[model samples]
Target chain A: MQVTLMQGILIGIFAIIAGIDFWWEGFYIFRPMIVCTITGLILGNLTLGIVAAGLTELAFAGLTPVGGTQPPNPIMAGIMTVVLAYTTGKSPATAIGLALPFSILMQYIILFYYSAFSVLTKKLDTYAAKGETKKFTQLALLPTWIVGLSYGIIAFLCVYGAQAPMKDLVNSMPVWLSHGFEIAGSILPAVGFGLLLKSMLKAKYVPYLLIGFTAACFIKFGNLMPVAIIGVALALIEYNRSKKDVENEKKMKAVMENVNNDGDDEDGI
Target chain B: MESKNTETTPKRGKLTKHDVKMLGVRSLFNQSAMNYERMQADGWTLAMMPALKKIYKNDEKGLADSLKANLQFINTNNYTAPLLMGLEASLEENGEKRSTIDGLRIALFGPLAGIGDAITWFTILPIVAGITASFAKQGSVLGPLIFFLVYVAMFFARIPIAQLGYTTGTKAISKIRENSAIVSHAASVLGCTVIGGLIATYVQITVKTKIPVSAGHTIALQTQFFDRIFPNILPLGYTFLLYWLLKKKNVSPVILILATFIFAILFSWLGVL
Candidate 1:
């Protein structure tokens, strides 16, 4: 289960590309599923990679960076999840639990970058004042390179340098602790769903939520497609109703304006 | 006003179609230099560079002033940002006052962020991710590919959206604001529904605690009690507890994640989970 130097370097290179994409949000290849899949591909474990991608994706589903706030970094979590599972010969669930520290570590690093990059604004101001478009453009793009390179170095170190320690740590874990990690992994997706609901849930929409929950949990289906179709249907109905409401409101306003115009004409006469 | 500007300032530079296309391309880097001080300000100015350069080709002072003005604080959804960029560029092309362009930019970003977040982040991606995660859970390769393609499509969508902004100019503002409310409401309806289904399907919580029903016989709590009453009740309740903590108590997600780990491990140690 030892990671080769070549594998580590490839993973590091992938990390750089994903890291820049994550920062720029140019293409969203940094999601846990994609990151894990690529890592698995590099490590020559495609099935393991796909399995971990599914589990890890759900766990990190609702942990999106909204505004300034960031959840634990998905790229590191994704890379380490597959790596831990691959190196330690454990289930994806257990690897998810073990990979959390790395994710949080990256989160802090990114936050640090956010604060550190604040210093560049003064540099930007100066460039603008001097009308140095070339320097300004270069400086503007500098942070992305820094972000990508940092990801590369960290991924390389974690994958290659820390393998022995990670393996040893996994071996030393008692049955209870390892089982506990498994349990934690299974329960973590609830937090993601909760975060999503916090943003999207509304008092009026609670019924649709209940319907979806009921259908998915109680009714037997081969997959969740039926439930999703129901959701789409509801969405269509809601969309049409709201559109009509807007139209009706506009009509009412038009009528009000017409009456006002009549009143103005009478007053002028 | 148009006639007066054309006669008096015939030397004013105009942005070509190529310039607008480049602006859309540059908008991809809108968050490249994101920071805490002014957020996406530097990136915003960079994205507007091509148009700014062309419109102010002979006026260095005007170019610098526009750059300084654009470098002020700006935070908005990256996808919808090109719309504002196009609008600002058009205004600058028309020789609009600096205050007018700056004021409109500030005024529009908040609403654009709200609409973009609602449509793209909350609704479309989450729903797609949920469905695709199910496929990936079963080890289907289509999962990642589909999600990647969908996102790529969204990335390219910036071109047409930017074009829409440029052609419609300021007149599009009222229409966008009018439709945004309805669109966001419908989007959230779908988002909530999908999230509810996702919670039921994705969030797994099992209770291993057993109770002796009769002599030498134990009933499994998870199956015998919780399942008989309502399947996935524990997951639903747990999701609600976390939601309540997040919304009412204002607990950070990082804290919630850590606490979930601790409690899960503690419960596992107690043989309750």
Candidate 2:
């Protein structure tokens, strides 16, 4: 189960790519679903990679970067989830719980980068003023390189350098504590859903939420497709109704304008 | 004086299709140098650089001034930033008043961010991720493939959207605002429903505690009591509690995550989970 040095290096390089994509929001391969699967591929455990992808993806679902504030680093969470599970021979669910500290650590590092990158703004301004387009472009890309390199180093160290200690630490944990991580893993998705609902939930949408929840919990489907279809239907209906409402409002405004014009004409007469 | 020059100059520099396309490509790095002081200001300038250079090829002072104006604390969704870039390119090409261009940029970025966040981040990505994660849970490679393809599609969509913004000029603003309101609303409805199903399917909590019902038999707490009342009441109730704490108490997500770990471990040790 030990990760080979070559595999570790490959993962580090992948982390670099994912890290830049995460910061750039370019390809979005930084998402857990993609990150974990690729990590799993390199580690020769594709099944575990896909399974962990599902767990880690849901666990980090609602943790999006809004404005300047970020949630815990998804790239780290995704990488470490597979790494811990692969190295320690634990369930991916248990590995998710164990990966929390690494995710949070990366989050702080990113926050620091946000502040540290401010120093470059003055130089950027200078370049822009002088119309040094080439220099300006190079300077603008500097932060992304730093971000990618840091991810490469950290992933290499964590996956390759710390494998033995990580395995020993997991082996030494008491039965209950290890079991606790499994339970915690199962429960952690709630925080992600809660964070999502905080932003997206409204009183009007409660009924739909309840419907979806009840359907999933009660009706044993092979998959979630039925619930997704229902959601799509509901969204379509909502879209049509809102379109009509917009049309009606426009009509009402037109009538009001006509009424005002009539009154002005009568006053003129 | 500037207005007089612009009115008299009928042969102002124009943007080519190639230039517009490049702007869209550059927008992928719109947050590359994101910093605390000016946020995406530097990236914004970078994305618009080629277009600005072309538009002000004959005037060095005008190019310098435009670059300075563009680098003034801009932050918006990366996908939709192309629209703004195109719009600014058109304005600069027409030699629109600097004040007019600045005012429009400031006015639109906030609303664009709102619409972009609602559609891309909250609605589309979450719904797709939810469905794909379900497939992925069963070890299906289709899950990651689908999600990645959808994201790439969105990325490429920036090109046509930018072109639309450029051709439509200022006329598209009100229409975009109107359509986004409806689109975001519908998307939210879909997003909420998907999230609800996700909560039930993803969040797992089962009561392991049991009570003695007879000398030789014991009633299972989870299957007999909790499941009888509601199949997933614990997960749903726990999700609600976390939501209340998050929305009402305004606790940080990091704190909430840590608290969940503590509660899970402590409760497991006590044999209650």
Candidate 3:
């Protein structure tokens, strides 16, 4: 359970990479499953690592950044969840509950990072106004390394510094609070589904939504792929039907215009 | 309007392949120094610097003006940003009407954002992550591996899309706009169904309650009634309730999260949910 200096550094590097991957390229290397697996690989506890990853992933699943606002920092949560599980020998679910506070803390850290870099953006504006291409480029990319390195340092600290204290703090917690966390862990996924529904739901897609819900709830399919396939079929059918309707409408409009033009020609004649 | 300067002006072939490729790659950091006031303005202008420099090679003032114009408050989908960048760059290189470039950028950004968010955030990531999580739940290494490889492909795929826009110039905009709506809508439908399936599969809340019918006999409500009627009714209902609360109340997500925790604990204590 003791993380060496080299492992800490490696985790730090991964943190930087994940940071860039997040808001930069839109890749999800920072997702809990990947982060935890990497942590497990480094820590030589794949079983516990995967377990912690799964728990944290689900708990954080509902929380995604919409626009500039972040939902709780899942990347930070994932790292701490694995670290806590590896160090304290806690169950995956327990570690997730324990890591929730860290996740929220990291959210503020990110906001601060955003605020701190505002000055850099101002500097970029000046450089850009002056057409100092080199300076502008340097300042433009500054936030990447700054944000990435900050996250890296935090990960290193979590692995190297917070181990014993985290274990103590988690171990000292009263039973009811921890049980509450266990329950909270189970209940939290609804938030993600809710957020997703809030964002993705449209009146036009109501039938599809009902179909999806019914297919899953009534038929009780064990896997998601089949339901997804059905969804694809339904969506394609609707999409094609709509496209044809649009085309037909266009054609009708064209014909009406032609008929009006003919009537005008007769009047002219 | 500026036709007299065309004979003396440099032609449209100023930007080399390298510049476009670099712009495509650099567009990844469009949010690097992003702020609330002018989101992606700094990073975007920075990414376009090289391209603008190429287009306005001898004209420092033109480059500065272009850079300044791009620093205006603009936000759009990250994936298709490169395409806009490419379109703008090509338009600049071709000495197209300035107003035309500005108009196209403003017009395309909002719609691109809608399409990009639907495809990337709502549909692809959720479905892929859900499937991978299911695999990871069983402690398979393939879970993480699949997520990484697939996502990495999607990430790198942005480069070509940008290159396509640059090579094709403004002609591609209408095509992109036309197709994106359909793509976005189709993906959303698929996304909803998959998310629905995910809700059923992942949001597990089992009722472990029993009711006594007589002194010697007790009936398990979950097993005797709920499961028989609908297997994952609790989870579905809970998800629906959360969705309704979010939609109707416009509750702060943080407050809703706290409420969820409190309710979970209280319900568990009461042995009801």
Candidate 4:
């Protein structure tokens, strides 16, 4: 489990990416597939990665970023869950079950940093006003990248530092407690999925949702096939609806023009 | 907002638009950037209103006033400070009236959300955590570095995006009257493609479950079809139940925590993986 130079660099890069997402977009960038794939690629455990990612994804599928509100920090959860799974050689489900509480803790840090960064915004704005592109870029990119990279580096150090002790502590967790986590993990994602599904509700979109649900419950196309299908359906529906509306408008405009001509004839008479 | 004794009917306890923008200054010291993180719509307006008014209406102060009107937008209101500013400069360059700010915001929101989701969520966040996770998986000692990387990225990246948004918003609006189709289409394509890629690459889940069949009873009872095929009757049922609870409840999501913990305990005790 010794951190290699290459591995360390990779971790730093991912950390930066995560930080950038928070700074720029403001949503949970982590996902189960992503966590699994990265962990798998890094640890030479593709199956483990997929499993871990799947577990994490399911456990937290419903989490979404709304306006000013924060959900649990999925990036933290997904990353940590994968790492825990890989290091411990535990199943994805088990890893996810164990990681939820830990992940929840990181959300506060994210909130704190976001609130704290207002100070930096004013400084950057003043710099930008003076046409200091270099300073502006420096201000904009450096802090976030630092945040992202530092998270990875620090986590790496801590994990490296605590490996043996944590392993013993986890191994010693009671059977019932461990099993409880598994069950809780299993049920958690439903809430997330529920939230997502609830948020996307609209009359026109309901048909696609039903289709997705049916496919999920019965057909089994796998992964997000149902969701993708919904996306496509919505797109098509919007397109078709707009197209028809345009055609109808043209017809109405022609009718209006005819009526206007009749009025001109009456005025001339 | 201060209360009144019917001299103003207390004015619904709402602050005037000026109060909102002034509050933005307080929020500046108190908070930064629009909080688009809630998956809500407030951030877009908050982050862009001030800048948008300046760009389209030739009124920088007006932009500030508009924001005060829309202060309820929370996290998004702060970032609008930068966006509207850049947009004002961009519009002034084109010699256009600044009245078109509202159109610009409506125009930009969808494309921004689409692009924003991918740019922030897909590309940047993953890159950071991917690096960190790689090490964490191997029991590397740099787990905390991964966390810090995210913090850094969050802090640094906002300025330019907000700035760029302003510049683009003002410019993009004018295009609506001149080759609007091409502009919106391009934005749509970029937005959709990024979203598609992210959803495909992320969101990983695998499911296995079965229905129970009622065939036989006590002595030499035989279980038929569903149970014979698989033994996951409970997991699927539990998933559905959880979904049901979520759909039915108006209760605070905190209740979900209680339910999750309770189920986890129950399942663990019952030996349900």
Candidate 5:
């Protein structure tokens, strides 16, 4: 069954709520797994939602935002992919298609929140001036819960309601066009892979990657054997070859021993 | 109970460019730990301390200064919400309504958390982890060994960023801007690879068939295809094609999805996934 647009909106709402509820933990709360799980519950296929969530999770498992650099939105992708997959039978890749825009929209929301929070500091400052230390902490708690709860509920409803209508709409489309959606699904995951590969393929390490892949493909060995054996052998060889100042160490040791004997001889005489 | 030293010692002697570079990592790490929103309200105040010393040293402001920033190099704070909450609660205690502050914060937290998590844990870690882990997962008993090597490199690499964040935040933006471009490019390269790897790992498919030999026996896929060349390379190729089209063509993922469904239907009708 295709998801009715109303259901699509519901799933979105559900995602928003669960997404920001981690206020105590602050803005680090929005995770793909959280949104995906909510999506699963909304779509009434908790298991598939989990699987989708896990795949998305592992795919972006190493996201590390350093400073202000941008990172691709995994939670948005996770939610949409689940919605699409459960409602339309598209694979994980197809679901990723709908998630990107939501992720982008969420980004600006963060910018606003970050800047707006500064005002709270001013209020706290005012309290601090009045010699009311306890009041400063109190002023901070209200905003945290309000925002956290709002995001949680909004996501819950958006995802929950969107589930049915989106499925219906997608399914009701011409059968041929439906086929087209499936085709799109197959090709989309590659984008995720490509994004990953752009970092993996470095100029120096290309040989290691190729060799590892080749050994996996060719060698009739047990799991994880060929690569490990070769890697260890190469590492040992490199360590041995890179031994620095070997001759200098020997000369330094000889000089130290000579000095000790000379000192003893002088003392005895 | 013991105030052995009234002031902390600063590093003596002229600092080199190398030292400056290393501080960025340290500064970043410290910035990452800037939770407790009220404390973090200065927005990189911890970083600007060296410069802050010049401005506020021995000033009449009686607040003691002890600051550290930590987020493991993904420089976003988790304390802001609580910080706001604390501030609001304090105001409430003083007999003022906090509804407006609540609305303002409600509107703020969701979007920031969404992007922050995505960038920190999603893009940077995976790309770095995937490549770093790939070395080990491919290694067997030595795999764990390889993982440690990568981990050490990443761990040590972060120290300077943390320090730099603290030092740079203290002064002007001139020094920070100079290095941002190179760092961004490096980050992008890493991020791009993750984009690729995430796709590669997404959809897993298996095709099974048995071929009969002359002696009245069938061969396993392992025995038959294992002897052939580039056995799983086809999947890699497929991912590349998808990535290129998406990036170059600007085609919507939805359209591509429709195409995939069509393809799957045709393949299924012809019996292929």
Candidate 6:
């Protein structure tokens, strides 16, 4: 479970890429699930990495950056969980308890990154005023490099330097607490689904949701791909039906307009 | 909104197809330098730099002024920002009035974000992430692989939307406005369905408690009732309760997370679940 020198460097590189990708394109590679998988792959335990990531991902899934507020940083949580899980040889769910503190710490680090970098905006303003487009562009991209490097450094330190402390933290947890975490780990995804449903649930689309839940609960699809295919098929049917309904309404309006125009012409005659 | 002359052909401007294509690529950085005060203003201005330079090649004052205008507290959803930037660039290229371009930019931000966030953040990401997460949980590599591939595809999809915004100008905006409802509806249906399935698949809440019916024959609520009658009812019910707390009661998600932790501990300790 020990991270090799090469593994630590590779993890650092991945962390750097995740940091830049977080803001640039937002492909969500920075998410705990994805990052942890990459870390696990480097550490030669892909299954452990994926399981650790899956647990942490659900915890953070409910925590999207809505408006100005920041979510608990999943990147740190995910990476640290994998590191702890590997070091201690504990269940991935137990690592969730150990990783919670780091997630909170990372949230503050992100706040610091934003507040500290806000000062650079003034310099950008000057460049804009001076019509220095090249400098303006370079300065604009500065935050990405800065954040990426910081993340890289943080990953290296965590995997290479803080291994003993993290291992101690993971090994010292009481049985009841670990059981609680296992329970929490299983149920936390509900919050994410709830948050998603909060935003997406329309009265008309409720039926489609029922269909999906029913299909999954009753049928043994084995994998998510088939359920997704079914969902897509249902969506296409719903979409085409709505499209046709709208078209019908439009036709009815046109016919009504024609009748009204004829009545006007008859009055003129 | 006075309609500007559509006769200003894109070919007359200095922006080549390659430059426009590059602008689309640069649009990926729309929030890289984001801050609270100006939000994405820096990124927006940066993304449009190549196009703005060509449009005001002779007028240094024009370039400075355009840059300043763009850096004025412009925040919008990242997915839709590129289209706005492309449209703004095209307007500047066609000699559109400053007030008109600025007004349009300001006006479009709220609506575009409202629609864009709803689709991209609320619906699409959750559905995709939920599906991928389930696969990942099963120790399948396809989960991360599919997520990475689909994400790249959607990320590149913005490039074409930006290109469309630039080439067609205001017409593209109107078209998007008109068709957005259908597009949003279709996506929402798909999103909702996947999320529903995800609730059944991922949100695990199993009761292990059993009631004493007779000596040496205790009836387990999980196996005898919940499992046989309604397998995912507890998970579905729990999901709905949280959804209510979030949507109706406006509970802070952090509080909800804390509640989840406490509930899990208390319930497991009490042998309820």
If you assessed candidate 2 against the hidden native complex, which CAPRI class would it receive? medium
Per-model DockQ: 0.75, 0.78, 0.61, 0.11, 0.07, 0.61
Candidate 2 lDDT over residue span A152-177, tens digit each: 99989988998898899999999889
* Candidate 1, RMSD to the unseen true structure: 2.5
In the range A203-262, model 5's lDDT, one tens digit per residue, is 644444455455555555433334445644543443343333444666889999999999
Query: Which runs in model 6 stand beyond 4 Å of their true positions?
Result: A4-6, A66-69, A248-269, B1-12
Off by over 4 Å in 5: A1-18, A21-30, A38-44, A58-66, A69-72, A87-93, A111-147, A175-189, A193-201, A215-269, B1-273
- CAPRI grade of model 3: medium
- Ten contiguous residues minimizing lDDT sum, candidate 5 chain A: A20-29
User: What is the total number of backbone clashes in candidate 5?
Assistant: 160
> In candidate 5, how many Å is residue A173 off?
3.3
- Error (Å) of candidate 6 at residue B217 is 2.5
Interface RMSD of 6: 2.2
Give the better candidate number (3 or 4) by TM-score: 3
Show model 2 residue runs off by greater than 4 Å: A260-269, B2-10
> What order do you get sorting by lDDT, best first?
2, 1, 6, 3, 4, 5
Q: Which pairs clash inside model 6?
A: none
TM-score of each: 0.95, 0.96, 0.93, 0.58, 0.47, 0.90
Give a tens-digit lDDT track for model 3, residues B32-139: 777777777887887787778878877766777788888887788788788888888888888876678888888888888888888877887777777777677788
- Which structure is stronger by lDDT: 1 or 3? 1
Which parts of model 4 are misplaced by more than 4 Å?
A: A1-17, A25-32, A44-46, A66-68, A124-134, A220-238, A249-269, B1-92, B97-258, B270-273
The residue-by-residue lDDT of candidate 2 on B1-273, one tens digit each, is 868666443455788898898888888878999889988888888888888888887676678888999989888988789998888888888878889999999889988887788778877777788888888999999999998999999899999878988988888888887898888788888888888888899899988998998898998999999999988889999999999999999999999999999999998999998
lDDT agreement with native, every candidate = 0.89, 0.89, 0.79, 0.47, 0.44, 0.80
By DockQ, the better pick of 4 and 6 is: 6
Residue-level lDDT tens digits of model 3 in A92-124: 776776777777877888887767777776676
Pairwise DockQ winner, candidates 1 and 4: 1
